[model samples]
Target: MSVETDSHGRLYLSSELRQKYGEKFHIVEYEDRLELVPIDEDPLQAVREAAGDAFEGESIEELRERAREQAKEDAEAGFERGKRTAEGGNE
Candidate 1:
């Protein structure tokens, strides 16, 4: 469908289109053209759907603890490597 903007630079959509896709839209600009993407009314639900099984069986606290432990291990490993280099030992 063809659409034109008014003097105020606002593009009006038909009632049919609005009913089908809701009132909110995200304007996507490409090199040659612009496209309108409908925005989901519930953003949190969209994120939960996109994440799928990422959290699976683990609680938030468990995930945080795992991340902290991994960071600690990585830091210790890096310190050991730096110490070895400082001592002029072969890696």
Candidate 2:
């Protein structure tokens, strides 16, 4: 998705990204691109900063793999949320 800046050069968030990342992630719109953030910062930090209980016992490599999986899940969830909202938020 893309965002248009105002005449005063203020960055405007893409509602598209917001709706998509509902409870999963967030996108910070910049003049040229967007920065992504996780919904949960994983305050637990028992392992990697992003690992939860399901991964507390995993190896470092395993934890990386799990992080990838979780990121994909969050992205898909966000995309679906965006789709639903695009369909008039009836979902």
In TM-score terms, which candidate is top?
1
lDDT per residue for candidate 1 within 2-88, as digits (tens), equals: 899999999999999999998999999999999999998997567657899776777768978998999999999999999999999
Q: Which runs of model 1 end up more than 4 angstroms from their true locations?
A: 50-91
lDDT of 2 at 85: 90
User: Against the true structure, candidate 2 has what lDDT?
Assistant: 0.70
Q: TM-score, each model?
A: 0.55, 0.38
* lDDT (10s digit) by residue, model 2, range 1-91: 5667799976555667657654455678999967767565453462455444666576778867988999999999999999999989865
Q: What residue pairs are clashing in model 1?
A: none
Q: Pick the candidate with the highest lDDT.
A: 1
Q: After superposition, how far is residue 41 of candidate 2 from its true place, in Å?
A: 21
Per-model CA lDDT versus the true structure: 0.89, 0.70
